[model samples]
Each structure stands twice: as C-alpha cells, then as structure tokens.
Target: MRVEPAALEQAASKAGALENELRSVDVALHTTAAVRGLAGWETARRLEQVQSRLQDLVTGLANRLGGVSERLAATARNYRDSDEAVRRRFDDGR
Candidate 1:
C-alpha cells in the first residue's frame, strides 16, 4: 500500500478532534449520571456504561490511528532508503 505522512497526519488530527468532542460528551455524561444516580434512576448505571464504552471505543481508535501513523512514517523512511540505495547503484554504473 502507498504511504503518505501528510494524509496520515490529517487522519490523526481528525481522530484527535473526535477525541476532543468525545471528551465533552464524556463530561456531560458524568454530570448526568451523577444527577440521575442521586435521583435513584436505574438508567443512571446504563448511562455510565455507555460512557465507559464510548471511552473504550475512542481509546482503541486513537491507538490504531497512532499505530497507522507510525507505520506510514516508517514506510516512507524505508522507501526513501531504498530509493537512495538504488540511485547510488545506478550512479555507480552497477
């Protein structure tokens, strides 16, 4: 597969933005859960569970994006090295 650092970086940025949005929702959920729990609502626990699952999803996505970005960077560097090696061989008339 072709690798592009800029594209990967952009994706990482988008993931980061989503993470930020999730953070806001997470805070809201915490507040809501607290209020609901105090009122003895059974849904409060479910809301908390939802928040926790969202957190897990976001965390997993962030980790995957990070790994992808690192792999893209490594691929770019490998390609560069290969290109340089080929160029050197060509220039040496090998």
Candidate 2:
C-alpha cells in the first residue's frame, strides 16, 4: 500500500517534535543529577568534619576525667594516712 505525502509529512513533523522534547528532558535530568551528586558530596564532607570534631571533644573530656580521678585518689590516700597517724598518737597517750 502507498502512503499519502501529507500523512508522511505530518508523521515526520510529529517525530521531530517528540525528539526535541526528549532532548530537553534528557538535559534537565542530567542537570538535576549533577546538582544532587554535588549536594551529596558536600553533605558527606560536612558529616566527616562533625565526626572529627566530636572525636576530639570526646578525647579531651576523657583526658580531663583521668586527671581528676588521679587527683581524687591521691587526696584520699593522704587523708587516710593522716587519720592513721592521729590514731597512733592517741593510743600512745593512753
């Protein structure tokens, strides 16, 4: 069967319009994807920085707590020794 020229022209115009629309959609999709990828990378970097900061803070707190514990232990030992000396002095007097 032979196709009419008018119908062929109409079909060709429709195909061209569809092709242009597809190209526009593809460009938009690529742009959106690139933006999303960039955002993801930035977010990951920020998270890493936060994690590093938190680790530093935790380490500092741990060091401070260790020093405090050591000081307290020394203070307790000194008090105990002083009490024992006082008790010995009282026993000798009696």
Say which candidate scores most in TM-score. Answer: 1
After superposition, the stretches of candidate 2 with alpha carbons farther than 4 Å from their true spots are 1-40
Q: In candidate 1, how many Å is residue 16 off?
A: 7.5
Q: Model 1 Cα displacement at 10 (Å)? A: 6.5
Residues 16-87, candidate 1: write the lDDT tens digits. Answer: 566555445554444564756556666676666676777787667666756665666566667677778999
TM-score of each model, in listed order: 0.65, 0.53
Q: Compared with the true structure, what per-residue lDDT tens digits does model 2 show for residues 1-94? A: 5434445445545544544443344333334445456576876566556656665665565555555545555555566677789999999999
User: For model 1, which pairs clash?
Assistant: none
